[model samples]
Target: MLQNEQEYIRILRSRLEGTMPHEELDDYLSDYREHFRIGKANGKTDGELWQSLGSPDNVAREIRVTHLVKKAEGNRSARNIFHAAFATLGLGLFNLVFVLVPFILLVVMLLMIFIVGVLFAIIGPVAFVFSLLQGGLPAFSSWISPLIGFFFCTGMTTFGLLMVIGDYYLARFFYHVGIQYLKWNISVITGTECSA
Candidate 1:
């Protein structure tokens, strides 16, 4: 069958239309057009150029992932990052193990840490207040002196606060590292290394 430039562009545009911004879609379409024009000028038929470029579906998938990753990097929003990660998964089944598994683990681990931190932060203060209001300690509390209990509770509160703060920094660090890793992974997968 004759695979013409228009047919390729149509497939690419249809795949990308709603997923990408108009200007970006136009830019990609124009780039493909230029490539075809140049190829023809160099004595390559549209079919030859199309064959070299691979299937339009595969090309569109790679382009979607690259664009999403860049948008995530630039915007630095949860929605953007999630979108990028999800788009990366579309690259292949390999990503289900590599990308999706790690992404799920990180999110679950972070959420668990945050929950523990918040629980400690709340429970420590509440226990301290109960100890004060009761004038004496309960059986479990009686194992330690009031002074020791106070110190322990204070330490717990401090630890919780630090955990929460540390978690924030860790998340930020992970975001930066994850973005770079995604870019690299996409490059390796799509055969298009980002200059940035």
Candidate 2:
């Protein structure tokens, strides 16, 4: 019985020294000891009991593989979720930069130009009519009215275009930064050693 217990202790120690978790090690050893005790009671010698349990290295390897498989599956699930979220957010940002922001800015610029043009168009005829009514001269006597409207529309269009370009580049910069951040975070989580 002493020899049987000593052999069990040796196997347990070696297995525990490996990457196996403490709870699993304890459970495996407890079950094996119980089996050994039963075999001893049934007239089997300590050597026979140890042999029946098979090679300690093989048993340890099996337990380690099981744990590693579980760990791998969990890591895979976490990685998938992480990747999905990153993809969604990146795409959303891309759309906002390349589509939504430019579209909205262009619409606003167009609306402003349209409103200004309409205002000038309305006021031009009214001023010309009032000037004719006054029998003196044009109150806003100038061909400069239409020219001002044209320049205003052109300036707003140019500004909106420049703003769209700036937004696009900024969005691209943010996308790259976000990607780098995610990569760094993943490396940290996975215990990867980053150089420099």
**lDDT leader:** 1
How many steric overlaps does candidate 2 have?
A: 0
Q: Which stretches of candidate 1 lie over 4 Å from their true place?
A: 1-55, 58-90, 143-145
Q: What's model 1's lDDT at 153?
A: 80
91 Cα displacement, candidate 1 (Å): 2.3
Report the lDDT tens digits of candidate 2 across residue range 1-196: 4446676667666754534456766787788778878888999998887777776656654555455455555777765444334333444464566456755675566556555555555554554445455543343345446545445545555555555555566566766765675555533332233333
TM-scores of all predicted structures: 0.56, 0.35
Task: Write candidate 1's Cα lDDT for 7-111 as tens digits.
Answer: 999999987876667898999999999999999999999999999999999999888888888878999987677777767766567687888999999989988
Please give the distance, in angstroms, between residue 32's alpha carbon in candidate 1 and its true position after superposition. Answer: 11
Regions more than 4 Å wrong, model 2: 1-3, 77-196
